[model samples]
Target chain A: MSDDGPRGQVGKDSFEARLKSAREKQGLDPKASDPDKRLSAPSAMGVGMRVGVELVSAMVVAVAIGWALDRWLHTSPAFLVVFVLLGFGAGLANLWRVMGPGRMPGAK
Target chain B: MPQLDFGNPLLLAQVVWLGIIFLVLYLLLSRWALPQVGAVLAHRAETIAADLDVARRAKEEADAAVAELTRATREAHAGAQAEIAAAVAAAKAKTDAESADLNAKLDAQIAAAEERIAVARTSALGALEQVAVETAREVVGRLIGSSLDPALVPQAVAGVLAARAK
Candidate 1:
């Protein structure tokens, strides 16, 4: 019975010390990231889709406009060829803007 | 196949239909779906902000409570240690006082025993002196016809006792 006294004291002291140390280690930060700051899997997928949409829209619009202009001016395939390359470049530009380091259309 | 031909009026009709469809889709999106999506996004942002504020307040309160608990625990430990020390001191004081009392009692008993031994020795010597004197008187009376003087007998006994002591 008497021997248990020192052991109990040691256990209690260690427990208190650990509690103090653990509490001291804790920081006051809220630990919640802003919902918009970092993209989750779904949001990242959404962003990727937007980029794809941008690229495809640019290419389609360019091709459509070039085709219509060629027909209207009787210029057979000249405008089509030039606009196709321009649309390809624009698509690449849109892709870069979407996926680049700025992360949220800030590059544009 | 006619789509590839520049003179095909069917291609013009197809282009017109594409524009019409694109316009309708854009109108639907701008009118209905986009506003809904924007509203949902706004609502989500508001909910998240509110949740974060609540979480921050809870975290701060928890930290404060933990800090207070640690403070109280430390104070309790100090108070307990002081109490244990005081108890130990009191116990030691009691033990010392008891030991001192026992030692004084033993000293008194030892002195009383010595006084008793001194008194017994003095009494035994006085009884031996009386026996020696009576023995000398009896021997002198038996040898010399019962006419021995008491004063002379005491003087002779004193002389013999002094010689034996030397």
Candidate 2:
């Protein structure tokens, strides 16, 4: 009788596996195999909004600083051009931070 | 456009007021609303954890009960098998004993019957010899008008019967 224990355990394990798959198919247990993937993935709309905010915020701040510096130094449009390029580069960097392989920002 | 007019003095004041409103809203959300939501979330988490604990314990109990049931069933099966073996052995022993006793009784009866048959055969042979002697004596008396010697008749009958037996 004790010899049946392992066989029963094997049967139970298969039953549990099948049950888990059925639950997953029914949307009851959602992708329980990988918690990290679920946690690190954001909705597409959220991604789009964050990207827009990151790019526009950096650009707006840069443009404001450039405009103020031009007023202070009397060098019109030179700092604006430089800061515009820098802002674009910063935006790209922020995008990389959000969508990079590290997945830190997305996880947060 | 009135909005784009740099000469407007109220634009700066508008920006200052906007900043003040933003700060007030941020403060209110951070101090009151967010914390309340966090507390409720924590409570729900605690409840879920407690429920999960209870469910886990129930599952463990069910597993234990199943194991116990299996063990009992196995034990019972084994016991039944043992009992069946014992019963079969007992029946076989009883049948063997009965057959052996019947065989012994039959053998004794057969031996006794054989002895009775032997006795009957010997008595019949003795009666045949006596009848032969009397029959010869009567034939001799009728032929000769005198009874033959009975002793002589017995001797002659005995001789003939002995030769036939041989």
Candidate 3:
């Protein structure tokens, strides 16, 4: 523009032509064809099933501990009730943690 | 009930098998499956991040290009407008100059025409005075039965006409 010469006009025209083609190319560019297309670990249903298994496993471990204690201490019913109730509460707590809002998605 | 008895030797065997199975499963998951799954997840994350990076760069480039285009277009538009204004100014100046020249010519013509009318008016008044003096000379000669001098008749007409103007 400052030159007001032939070369400046040529440069401006070429630049304008490039801009027009670039705009066309930009339109043609396929944007991020598969952005989130990746191997994800699991779905919500899978996570839910794992959480249920964790809850059940917690109760099963408590039951086993209670049974072993009863067998060793020779006190059967007394520990059974307390351990079973404890196991039930532990299972509930495990379920709560697994399904919590802050829990990571697809957590094992 | 017998199967439930912890004192049975079969219970010891069951516990050993359970430990062996758990160990094998743990190894399989920790050493093999978990790493494979983790690697896949990492690869996916890297791919997504790379795509996002490319997208950000492209967007920045596009924005800069668009800004450059807008600046160029504005400059071109301003140039065109200035050119148009210059053309209009040139035309207006030409028209103004032409009209000024025409006005001067018309004024000269009008002055010449007015001078001609003034000269015509003076000659017409001089002719009317001559005619009045001749008529008076003829009538006075008839009434008095004597002829009047031409110089005297003109002098008398001049006095009458001068008094009429007053």
Candidate 4:
């Protein structure tokens, strides 16, 4: 029983050391602090869909405007050809903006 | 095919009807359905934000409590260490003082015993010298049939005893 005194003291010291380390781990755990990695995983498909949508929407608007203008002026497809090129350029621009280097991670 | 037949008068009517239907659907969605959906979304967002705020506050309070606990533990540990050190020093001082007191007492007793032995030996030697002088004087008087000088007996005994000592 007397020997238990030192043994208990050693056990308590070890437990305190472990508790301190565990607390430190909790405070500075990288996974706990950076949740964007988890959020970005499931949204990988969403990012692709968003890029496609952005490119298509710009081209659709451009082509629609070009077609309307041509119909109004009674042109022989010259405006449509020019507008198609412009639409292609706009679509590329939209795609660049969607996946651009300047874009922030995890941004909507 | 009917849509592509621009010559058909019915196609024009169909177009007008389609426009009217599209406009109505758009109006319905924009005026009622979209706002309701937006309101639901806003309410959900507000609830989530409130919950997050509560969680953040709770976490902050927990961190503060942990910090306070750590500070208290460290202070208590330092206090305990200081008290233990003081106790150890006191014990050591007390033991040293006790041992020193014991050693002084033992030394004094040894010196007193040695002085007593020296005194006893000196007295015994004086008695032996007196006995030797008396015996020598008596034996010489008996052998020569005459009394000897007491001063001469003592001086001779002293000279012999001094020679024996050397």
Candidate 5:
């Protein structure tokens, strides 16, 4: 068959070819992907623990200083009692400092 | 160890001295250490609050910047989509117009081809009719042993040509 002529056969062939090309162009192809995660809790807890340790250290230092002062004064039990109580007060103050803003009960 | 005399006036006086020392220490702490420590703590708290405020403001500003960028990005995306849609629509419209033009051209070509075919067929039929008439005349002349009219032949040919033209 002489199907290469410009009338019946050639027109039908061109229309079919254009239709197939359009369908191929409009085809959809999708792909899958992943998402990300975050970490915050452990780090915040570590920071809080560090602050507590600092307050305790300050209290220990205050107590040691009071003991040394009592020994220097040579007042035996008298200075020891007074200095220890002062150290306790200083420790509570240091704890309050670490706590920040809000006052702790029995601290005064 | 020997028992210390807790009932002795000297021991009681020493105990009273210790109590006095504790009172003095308490007074000193209440007057000096507490205020100084409280002041330091208040200052630190203020500093922390200021830092937190600064951080919060910075975060808010960053958030605002991100929001603005997102809005701009969305707007840009929408604009690009609109542009793409417009381009596609224009292409479709142009394609439709071109197809219509091609269809009209094809129709014209088909009509011209049909007219040419019709003309060719009419010409071929006219030639066939002339041949038939010439053959008939020759056969008739041979059978009758006489020559046909030359003017009648021309007139018959003219009539056949006119009929074919219609």
Candidate 6:
């Protein structure tokens, strides 16, 4: 029985070794094999990119609204400057909301 | 050659009124309208983000739960299989042991019956031998004189036994 135990252990060791080698050959880490990790990284990056897109779009809309108001009011730069600043402030506030402590990229 | 002068008080008054109106409108927009819109937009965005985050987290949790359930299912399947196998093996062992015991009991019964038959056969043979001897004695008594001696009977019986042996 003791002899059989060692033989069984050796078989298991070789099988594990072969499996490890195969995984290494496939450029995979045994410990990092979780598929969730792969998805999470990309998802976080995508969220960050989305937030950036939202911020940029908000800035562009704010500027456009400000320009249109300036034209309508016949106030060349007054509304433009003021609304642009307000738009920037609004954009920053949005950014803070998106990227603040509890509103992290991956946070719920 | 402008009809109205640049320094006209009416024009200046109009500019002042416009400024005042603009300031009031700006104040109204900033203090009331813009803030409300901003709050609503912010709330909407937050709600959307929160919903998205909830969806993402739920998906992740669901995935994890599915993985865990799968693992548990596999483990349960394995455990059930092992238990079933053990039950079957135990049943088989019990059946084998019972069969062996039954076979042994049957063999013992057969042996006992054979021994009884042998004893009965021996007893029957002995009875048959005694009857044959009695019948032979009766035949000899009838064939010979009724007054035949007991001492001659032994000699007659010995002679018959010797002839039979030859």
Each candidate's TM vs. the true structure? 0.47, 0.62, 0.45, 0.50, 0.45, 0.43
Top candidate on DockQ is: 2
TM-score of chain A of each: 0.52, 0.60, 0.53, 0.53, 0.36, 0.48
Off by over 4 Å in 2: A1-108, B1-20, B147-150
Deviation from native of the Cα of residue B1 in model 6, angstroms: 13
Model 1 clash pairs?
none
For every candidate in turn, the CA RMSD to the true structure comes to 9.9, 6.9, 11.5, 9.7, 22.7, 19.2
| CA error at residue B49 for candidate 1, angstroms | 5.9
Q: Over the stretch B1-166, how does candidate 4's per-residue lDDT look in tens digits? A: 8668899999898889999999999999999999999999888767766655565567668668767986898899999999999999999999999999999999898988888888888877788888988888888889987987779988998899899989
DockQ values of all predictions = 0.07, 0.14, 0.05, 0.06, 0.01, 0.02
Candidate 2, residues B39-78: lDDT per residue as tens digits? 9988876776665556556766878999799889989999
lDDT of 5 by residue, A33-98 (tens): 223332323455664675566556665676676677778986666755665676667656765674
Q: For model 6, how does the per-residue alpha-carbon lDDT over B1-166 read when each residue is reduced to its tens digit?
A: 3437877788788889999999999999999999999999888767766655565566568668867986898899999999999999999999999999999999999999999998998787667556666666777888884746656655666567668759
Rank ordering of all candidates by TM-score, starting from the highest? 2, 4, 1, 3, 5, 6
lDDT by residue (A1-108, candidate 3, tens digit) is 446557855866676565445444444334445546544666778877776787788878888998899999999977777888898888888777756655544445
Top-scoring candidate (lDDT): 2
Model 5: lDDT of residue B143: 91
Q: Residue B22 of model 3: what lDDT?
A: 100
lDDT of 2 at A18: 64
Residue-level lDDT tens digits of model 1 in B1-166: 7657979888898899999999999999999999999999888767666665675567668668867987898899999999999999999999999999999999999999988888887677667667777887888778876867777766777687678769
* DockQ, computed on Cα atoms, for candidate 6: 0.02
Identify the CAPRI category of the predicted complex in candidate 6: incorrect
Model 3 complex DockQ against the native:
0.05
When 1 and 2 are scored with DockQ, the better candidate is 2
Candidates by lDDT, descending order: 2, 3, 4, 1, 6, 5
- Distance from true position, residue B151, model 2, in Å? 3.3
* Model 1 lDDT, full chain set: 0.77
Name the better of 2 and 3 by DockQ.
Answer: 2
